[model samples]
Target: MSAQAVDGLSRRGLLKFSVGATAFLATAGVTASLSGCSSSDTAPGFDALRTSDLPFLLAVIPVMLDGALTGIPSQSATERTLHGLDSGLSHLSPEMLKLTRQLFDVLGMAITRGPLTGIWSPWENAEPGQIRHFLGRWENSSLELLRQGHSSLLQLVLMAWYSQPQSWAGCGYPGPPKI
Candidate 1:
C-alpha cells in the first residue's frame, strides 16, 4: 500500500526532513562524544545524568520551576530534583534514552550548543536571561526538532520535581493517604 501523504509536504520532502534531522542529531552526538567533552561519567549519585548535564540542569531548574521551588533551599531542592530525574530517566525505553542523551550531548558541547542554542558561554556560566532566551528560542522555534527537544527537557524536569515527596506539599497533595 502507498503511504498517505500530508496535504502540503510531499513524501520526498518529509523523507528529506527526517533524514536531515537524524543526520544532525548523529553529527551532534558524534562530535560531542569525540571532543572528549561529553563525559559519560554520571553526576554525583546520579544513575543517568552525566557530569556534563549537571550545570545545565542546575541553571535550568530554577528558571523552569520558578514559583514551584519557593521556600525550598535552592541547592537541596536542585539536587533532589536531579536525583529524581536520574532515577526516572533510568526507566525510559532505550530509544528514548538515546534521544535524550543526544539532546544533552548537543547542549553539553560548545560547538553545537552555541550555534544551536545561542548560548555561547558554558552552562555553568549561563545567566537566567540567557537560559530563558535559549529555552524560548527552542520552544517557539519553527523547527519541529527544536520544539520537541524543548518539550522533552521540560517534561523530564517537571516530572522529576513533582514526583519527589518533598514537592508534594507545594502542590497541596497529601502523602497518598498514608499508604
Candidate 2:
C-alpha cells in the first residue's frame, strides 16, 4: 500500500524483486558450491570471515569509515576494525550469518566480484577511487539487493568503528556518563 516509487517500480514491486533476486543469488551460490568455490581456509584472527573475504572488507572499511580512520596508522586501524567486525559478527542470527557469508562469497569470487562490485583488482591493489565508485554504484543501484548490500556494509563498518572507544573522539561522542 506504500505510494513510494523508485525508478518507476512501486515499493511492493521492489520488495518482490528483492526477494526474487535473493532467491536467484542463493541458487547461484548453491550452483557455484558444486564447483568448490565456497571453501576458503580460515583467516588467522577472524571467526566469521574466510581468509579471502578479509581483504575485501579491509578494502571497504577505510572507504566507509574514512574520516574516523584518518591520522590512524593504516595497519593498526585495519586490525582493530577487523577484530571489532569479527566480534560483532559472532552474534548474528543464523539466517543473517548465512546471507552475510553469501555476500562475502560473491565478493571473493573473481568473475562475480568484478561485475557485481566493480572492483576488478585484488583489494590490496585497489585504488580508493575504484572502491568509492563501487560503493556509489551499490548505494544508488536500482536493484534493492544492491542497495541493501550497501546499507549492510555501511552499517557494519560504522557500527564496528563507532563502538570502539578510540573512534568516539572523532565523532565527538564522549563515553557514557557515570551513574
Candidate 3:
C-alpha cells in the first residue's frame, strides 16, 4: 500500500501522533498547572471555608482520592433525592462518563464477584491515616501529571473535576453533623 493508507494510525503513525500531542500541550497555557488539595480545613495551608458545604466535600472527596468517582451514584438519601440527581446528572462530560463506567464496574464487581475474591481496593482498609495517605498520593500524582501536560489522559481527568459543579448535597449528601 506504499504506506499511503491507514491515515498513519498504524504503529508508526501512533508514535508520531503521541509525540505531537505531548509537545503541543507542553507548549500550551498555564491553566493546566494544578496542585493537590488538602483534605480538611484544619490541614496546614488548607482552605478554612466551606465546612458547612457537605455536598462540596462529597463532590471533591472521591476525586481527591482516586482522581475519579466524581460522579458515582448515591445511596445516602431518600429515593426522591436519588431520582432527582439521576435526571440532572444523566449526562457527564466524556471524561467523567469514562470514570463513571470504571467506578460502576468496580461496584458491580465488588457486589457480584464478592469481597476478598474480587478486586482489592486499598480503601477497604481505610482508617483516617490510610485514607489521608491514599488521598494525598492520588491528588499529588493527578496534579503532577497535569502540570507535566505531556499526557492527554490525566488532563482529561483534570477537566472532569473542574467541569463538574462541586456540590454533593445535590447528589444526596445531607449536611454534615454539627460539631
Candidate 4:
C-alpha cells in the first residue's frame, strides 16, 4: 500500500482496468463452473493452491525468526533489510489478513488461467540480488519460527502469500507467457 504503488495504479486507465478485469474474471469463473462447461479452461492456477497455500506461506514468517537470531541486529549490515522485511510482514493486522485471504483466493483463480504477474518481484527497484538477500533472510527468520510450530508465525506466513502481488494481479492482470 505504498504511495508509489497507488501512484502506479492511478496512472491512465489502469486503475479502472484492473478493477474491471477482476470482476470479469470472477464472474466468468462462477458462470463457467455453474454451467459445468469445463471451468478448468477458464481457471487454471486455482487447483494448485488448495487451502494449504495459506498455511505454507504462514509457516515462512516464523521460519524467519529462526534464521536471524538477533532481533534488530546492531552490528550487521543486514540489520536494515532484516528489520524492514520483518516489520513489513510480521505485523499481520486483522483487516490486512482478511484482505490477504481474499487475495489468495483471487490469485489461485488467476493461476488457473495463467501465471501470475506483478506479484512475486518486489517493486522497490532493488537489484534482484538485494531483494533476495532481504526476502531470503526474512524467510529464514520465518523458518526459525516454524521450527517451533503452531505459532502465529504460521498464520502470518499464510497471510504473506495471501497478500502477494501475484495473487492480487491474478484477480485481474493478464500476465506474460510462462515459456
Worst 10 residues of 2 by lDDT: 1-10
| lDDT score at residue 10, model 3, on the 0-100 scale | 80
By TM-score, who's the top model here? 1
The Cα local distance difference test for each model comes to 0.83, 0.77, 0.35, 0.38
lDDT of candidate 1 over 87-171, digit per residue (tens): 9888999788777887888887777889788999888898888999999999997668888989999999999999988888888
Off by over 4 Å in 3: 1-88, 93-95, 103-124, 142-179
Candidate 4, residues 1-179, lDDT tens digits: the string is: 99988788676466576566657645544554455432222122232223323332332333343343333332231323233333443355756543433433333343432322223432323344443344444345323321222234345444443344333343453555579
Tell me how many clashing residue pairs each candidate has.
Answer: 0, 0, 2, 26
In candidate 3, where is summed lDDT lowest over 10 consecutive residues? 29-38
> Could you estimate the TM-score for every candidate?
0.83, 0.81, 0.26, 0.26
lDDT of model number 2? 0.77
What C-alpha RMSD separates each model from the true structure?
A: 4.9, 4.7, 17.4, 18.3
Q: What is candidate 2's lDDT per residue for 22-125, written digit by digit as tens?
A: 78666666655557777645677778767767878888787777667656776677678888888888789967877777787777777777878787877888
Q: Candidate 2 or 4, higher lDDT?
A: 2
Q: What is the alpha-carbon lDDT of model 1 when measured against the actual structure?
A: 0.83
